[model samples]
Target: MNGIELIVIAIAMYAVAYKLYGNFLIKRLEVNNSNPTPSHTMNDGVDYCPAKPPVLLGHHFASIAGAGPIVGPVIAAGFGWVPVYLWILFGAVFIGGVHDFSSIISSVRHQSKSIGFIIQTYIGESGKKLFLLFSWATLILVIAVFTIIVADTFTHIPSSGTSSILFILLAIAFGLAIYRFKVSLTIGTIVGVILLFLCIFAGNYFPIQLNALTWQLILFAYIFLASVTPVWILLQPRDYLNSFFLYALMIGGLVGVFFAAPSINIPAFSSFSLDKVGYLFPALFVTVACGAISGFHSLVGSGTTAKQLDKESDARLVGYGGMLIEGLLAVLSLTAVASMVNKEFIDILVNKGPVPAFSLGVARFLNAIPFLNISSEAGQTFSALAVSAFALTSLDTAARLARFMFQEFFEVKENPEKESIFQNRFVATGITVAIGAALTFSGQTMSIWPVFGSANQLLAALALLALTAWIAYLRKGILFVMIPMLFMFAVTLTSLGMLVITNYNSENYTLSVISLLLFLLAVSLGFKTYNVLVNGKETSRELI
Candidate 1:
């Protein structure tokens, strides 16, 4: 099949899903524009504030569509384009989009509560604690890995490093201008774009050359501060500003795909080999988790996006619509990798990192644009910076969510009269950063990340279950969420079991133990949720 055909088909699928299934979801959820969102009702400006749909959409997309989709699809291409494409198509429509859409609406309905707290409300108090701890740990691992990824990108390519620094400063300035100085969005955005261009040139001329470890330390410190600050002050404005770069990357790649008209050079399938890419059933599911269905999307949906949503109507656009867009990105990444890249480049991507593979493929695509005059080197650098922007945008959002999880874990709100040091935002964010930093430097994180797929999918299953419960409480049919939840639970559990066996055989008992514990926890929670569902009993008044 031709690469252009693949892209066209993928686009068609996404459009059809968005119009038909997405509309179905919006109708079924009974989204009402008349209802005031938590952002308006609880306008705190720090954590809760009404945001325009465009601005919130930028933040939502930037937060959820990280490098995971690119990396996962590129690597999973080992199983062939057919399997990956099929999963990305159907999974995004039936599973991922549903998960993201339901998560946001569910949280909005619950007054912008975190999924962990929602789990507690629908399940049990213990369920809440367990879910929060599990989610917090996962966020730490996510932060550590993404931190290292960005820092390593900067350490190797000093130009991107400089651009990233300038990018942050621009975000802060944009935040202050809009929030503090009352500047119009149009002016703030214009200035941000100009500064971003300057950032590119300035980075090329004067780059910051630091080792990966040093960059990691510096980034962790920045995250510590960004996490505790108000969302509008840093996270929202930064993400909104950084989104332009991502938008450019996506547009450029799409134009490249259209004009380049590349062919699918890679094999259609790998004959279903475990040694090559593991069993296709569970491994394929986990490997392609992000583009298809990611639990992390649920976190972002419920974490900050719900809090800032201006109206219930926007949830469809921001949640369901965002996942479909991400699915398209995954398709584009896979198309580029399979058609434009070679075996040697694939090996480097597998062994080193997926960034180079994506950059090179993007470079090839952009090379076809005659008027752009984009050289191979220039395209590679641009793609790298764009990917780095995605990772860096996600970093602080994850940290802030982790801080919220920490506060919930400590029951900080149970008694508003007394102050607890641990409940302080700074203290919570500090702990989150410290744990993530320690993990980043531990050297075990690289080994542990493989299990991340299972853990992440497990989280998604749990999120789906939570959403299912919420729908059940509303007395709506939950067949949509329930089917996916059962499938994900089985797939993730199987993947976790496989990881346990794989680790034990390799004598990596530490990871084996950790995976086993996670497996057990997921199973236990699954069982509890099942018991509640079957018995038709509500244990917590929080749900009512």
Candidate 2:
């Protein structure tokens, strides 16, 4: 099939899932109810706050949909399009969307707490702590890896002085408009997006060019400040504005696929090869998680999303339906990579440059539009900037999440009780900045990417197991969850084991071995917790 056809198929699949499963099954299951109030109910008109549906959707989408969807598929195209396409559709509908929707619903029904808190209540405290620790460790890796990615993308741009200045100005204006002027979020976002595009255009007129090192330093500084600041002042406003970039990216990708009409020539299944950097089974599952399904989404779903859900009924559409849209994004990304000739695609991959390849593909579409001349170089630069924007947004979200995880882990109590909330927020932000700084200095962030896919997949497996056990305990069916959970667990464990052995032989094994061992330990704990749940033992809730 051609690229356009694949995109159409993906959209149709998502639409059907939204209608039949999201709307119908959600109502049938009686999952729509507004009883259990979210725990973090207090709102200060910013973070930890309730919001209207549109704004909440924007926030959720920006946080959950990141470079994962784009980068994963592009990387997976090394295997072929068929596996990428299949995994996205099936995984998004059955695994990813279900996990996201159920997590949000569970949180809403139990007071909007983090997933760890809810696990404590339903599974046991031990289970909760284990999950939280695993989650926290995973989040730190996420923040570290994404920070490096953004830095790399920014530094890759030809040192145009105008772009850097414009970006800083845009950020300042965006920060003030939302935090000081109290402008409507929607309006501020629109203005910020417009200004960002203008900066890109104005970049061409600048005589000054930035070097890679300078861009890196500047970006690190920006991240440091952004991490410590309040969400309203920077993170939220920036993410809100950046959503437009994601939208434009999606549009560009879709249009490219449609006009190019490139056919998928990769076989339905490639030889089972382990010699490649990323193998198929587990890697495919991990790489495609954000687009199809992600345990990370549960973090966002239970963390901030539950608090802002205006009504219980919105959960299906916002949670499940939204995931499907992300799945479509993955599909489009896959189509773009798949459409390229094998030799051309390999050259791009060998160059270690996704932006250039993506832009070249996009230029083909632009050229198809008569009189619209988009040079390959210009397209490449645009792609680079877009990618940089994507990486930055992901970094911000991941940093915030890491902060949340740290605070939850340390459980540092606030004095005078009333100050507890503020204390928690402050501590979390501090932790985020510290981690970001460490990662920037160490330069070990990219090393973590190889394991990122597996770690994330493992988290999803654990979450599904917990959710399934909870449902079964509540007299719901368990088989549906059990089958996939076991499959993913096996796949992830195998991959983790392979990574451990490879690292061990290389004589650089401390962190990798530790991570592998910890994952195994978690697996053991998860099984013990599962047995307790299934047997209906009089267990202390703290064991979770």
Candidate 3:
């Protein structure tokens, strides 16, 4: 099949989903534009300030889109693009989109509480604690893995290092302009794009190469600060600005696939042997988590995006739209790799332990742009910078989410109670980043990616279960959410069981234990949440 055909079909499916299924969710959720959102009701300058849909879209998309779409599909391509493509297409529309949209709307309804709090309101206190713990661990893993991922990208490509620094500086400037000087969105976006391109130019002229360890330390410090700062100061504006690069890359990829019209060179289906890429049953589903459905989206959607949402109606756009776009990115990444990546480079990609495999795929896509003067090396560097931008957003956003969970853990109810030094945002953020940094420094993050994928999908299943409980509480239709939840539960639990066997064989007892624990937590939580949905009398009455 032609690569462009793949792109076209994916786009068509996403469009139909947005029009049909997305609208169905919005209506089902009863998104009332007249009702005040938490952002408007609370209006806390730090985390709860109301944001226009467009800006929120930028932040939501950038945060959730992180290297997952690129990295997951590229790694899963060993099973061939056909399976990956099918999963991305169907999974995003039916599973991921629903999960994200429900999480956001649920949070918005609950005054922008995290999914853990929503679980508490509808499920039980015990389920809430377990879900929050799961969510926190997932966010910390995100921080550790993404920090290493971005640091490795920067270390590998000096130009990306230079460009990443420039991107940060530009984001700060844009934030100051928009928030302090009250710059218009149009002008701010224009300035941001101009500065972004300038960063690319500056990157080539003044590259800053560093060792991987040094980059990791610096990134840890950067996220520590980024996490504590007010959202308007960095997180929102930075992600909004960084999103331009993502949009450009996605659009460029589609255009390249269309005009270049590359043929599918990779196999449509590889053997299901464990040696090649594990069994297609669980490994394929787990390895390709983000492109299809990821539980991490629930963390971002409830933990941050809900706080900034301006309208209840916008949840459909920001939540469902973001997943579809990420799915499109996954499709693009798979097409680029399947059609263009050389056989020899696959070994290098596996050995080198960075994102350059996808970078090289993106480079080929860029090279196909009509009349573009980009060299292979330059295209690779640019792609690296773009992916690093994604990693950067993911690391800090994950850090921010971690901080939220930490504070939530303490259950500090008021401003006076939160005055304790330990409750300070910096302290919370510092503690969160510290744990992730330790894991990253130990070089354990990469080894745990498979397990992380399982945990992530499991989180998605749990999130869906939570959503189903809430829908049941409201006496609303929940078959949509419940079906997807069951599917993900099966896929992820099987993946976790397989990981237990693999980890035991490899003598990685820690992961083995964690996998078993997660399996148990998921099953127990599933049984409890399902009972909450079934036994209506048992539903928690203390809720928003």
Candidate 4:
């Protein structure tokens, strides 16, 4: 298969899906901008504040993105480009789009609360607790995984470190300039984009070398601040700008694929069982979560994006369109590896990591363009740094989402006057990041990646179960939700069971036990959702 054909097919499918299937979701959700969203109803300036759809899309897309689309697809190419390709294309449209769009709408209807709240309303109080515990722990793993990824990126490509720091400082000023002050979006964005380009150029010229451990510590401290601060102050603006980096990369990559017309050297079907991940059946599904469907997207949609959504009408673009855009990225990531030979692919995957394989592969794609005049070394560095910067976006966003889960977990619903130390955002955030930081040293990044992927898919299953209950409450079509829910549950449970046995034999009891816990949580939630949908009283009520 040619990379260009893959790109073309992906683009067409994604566009059609966003429009046709997106309308189906809109009818079920029954949304309108005429109605006030949680962002307006519960405007708290910090976590809950209305944002323009474009800016929200940028932030939402960047948050759920990071390196997942690149790293996962690049690594999963080992299984076979064809399988990974098919899954990313159809799974993203049918499964991922539905999951993300419904999650946002569910949260919006419930005053932009987390998925735990949706479960609590449709399921039971106990179910909510289980889901929150499951969700919070999943988020911590996300933080740990991303922290290690970003740190390692910086350690190897020191230019990424310099670029990231520059981004942080620039994002702060950009946020205040456009949002706080009276600067027009046009003027502010113009200056901010120019500065962003300068940051990229500066990164290549002046690099700051640091070890992985030191980078990890610095990242922990940075996320601590990023989480506690207001959304617009740092995260929102930073991610908004970060989206441009990704958009440029995707566009350039597509153009490169067109010009290069690279024939895939890797087999369309390599083996049923991939080299490291063993079985392809469930491993490929879990490994490619972000590119296809991810539980983490639910967290971001409900935890942060729902809270900031300007209107119900914008949900389709931010939620549904975001997933399609990401699917395109996953296709590009796979194309990166498909263009390489088995020897080069294995060497990069085994030696460096997924990011570098994607980086080097994409650099070659760009090199095929005659007019741009990009060198291999410079293009590769740029690709790696861009990925690392987005990975940093995931690190802090996970911390904030984790903090939200922690605070919500401890809330005294019965007695509103009751107070606890856990209610304090700083305390909750500190505890969250502290725990994630601890896990960074617990295992190597590569060792942790597989478990992280499994746990993430498991979380998605639980989230889908919760979404099914919500759809039942709405008295809408539950078939769409139900199918994906069951399929992911089957895939995740089998994968986790495999991990439990695999890790236990390797004497990795910690990860083994963690996998078992995730398995238990999914089963518990599935039962709860089942009982609610079948045994509970009629759910049709005034909810909008």
Error of 4 at 99 (Å): 0.6
lDDT over C-alpha atoms for residue 343 of model 3: 74
User: Which residue ranges in model 2 land beyond 4 Å of their true spot?
Assistant: 36-40, 158-192, 203-221, 224-230, 371-373, 412-423, 478-482, 537-544
Expressed as tens digits, the lDDT of each residue in 1-544 for candidate 2 is 6877888888888888888878654753467455534523555444555445555665677788876787777777776778878899998888788888877777776656667766666667776778777887777777667655655555455434466457656866787876578888778777788897888778776635546556556665666566556555566556656666667767766776666677875555565452445667666776677887777888878766776676777787778877887898788767666667778877887786655666666656555544446666666666666666666666666666666666565543232234355347656676666665677678777766677777787877777776665655555555556666777787678778877887788776775776587568557756765676656643332221
- Candidate 3 structure quality by residue, lDDT tens digits, 1-544: 8888898999999999999998899888898999899998988789998887888999999998888888788877887777889999999999999999999999999888888887878777788879888888888888888887788778877788888888888888888888789999899899789989898888889989899889989988888888777788888988898899989888876887766788888788775753645888888888787778998899999989999999899998999999999999999888877875447446745785336777777677778887776777877767777887788888889999988887776664444244566667888888888899888878777777668888988989888988988887786777888889889999989988988998899999989999999999998988888687657673543232
Instruction: Evaluate all candidate structures by whole-model CA lDDT and list the values in order.
Output: 0.86, 0.68, 0.84, 0.87
Task: Please identify model 3 stretches exceeding 4 Å from their true place.
Answer: 274-276, 341-354, 412-422, 538-544
TM-score of 4: 0.96
lDDT of 1 by residue, 322-431 (tens): 89888988988898888854676558666766778888888888988888989989898888788888899888889998988888788744673475777788899988
As for model 4, its CA RMSD to the true structure in angstroms is: 2.3
Clash totals for all candidate models: 0, 17, 0, 0
Q: What value of lDDT does candidate 3 attain over all alpha carbons?
A: 0.84
Which one wins by lDDT: 1 or 2?
1
Candidate 2, position 180, lDDT: 76
Sliding window of 10 residues with minimal summed lDDT for model 4: 535-544
> lDDT rank, highest first?
4, 1, 3, 2
Candidate number with the higher TM-score (2 or 4): 4
- Candidate 4 per-residue lDDT, tens place, 1-544, comes to 6999999999999988888899988987788878899888888889898888888999999999988899889888988799999999999999999999989988998888899988878888898888888789878878888887788788877877888999999999988987789688778878888899799879869999989999999999999999989998899999998888888888888898988899999988888897677788898898898879998999999999999999898999999999999999999999998999888898989998898899888898888899998888877877877787788998889999999899888977687357689978999999998899877877754565667787788777877888888777766778888899899999999998998999999999978997898788788788877777667763443323
Candidate 2 has an lDDT of: 0.68
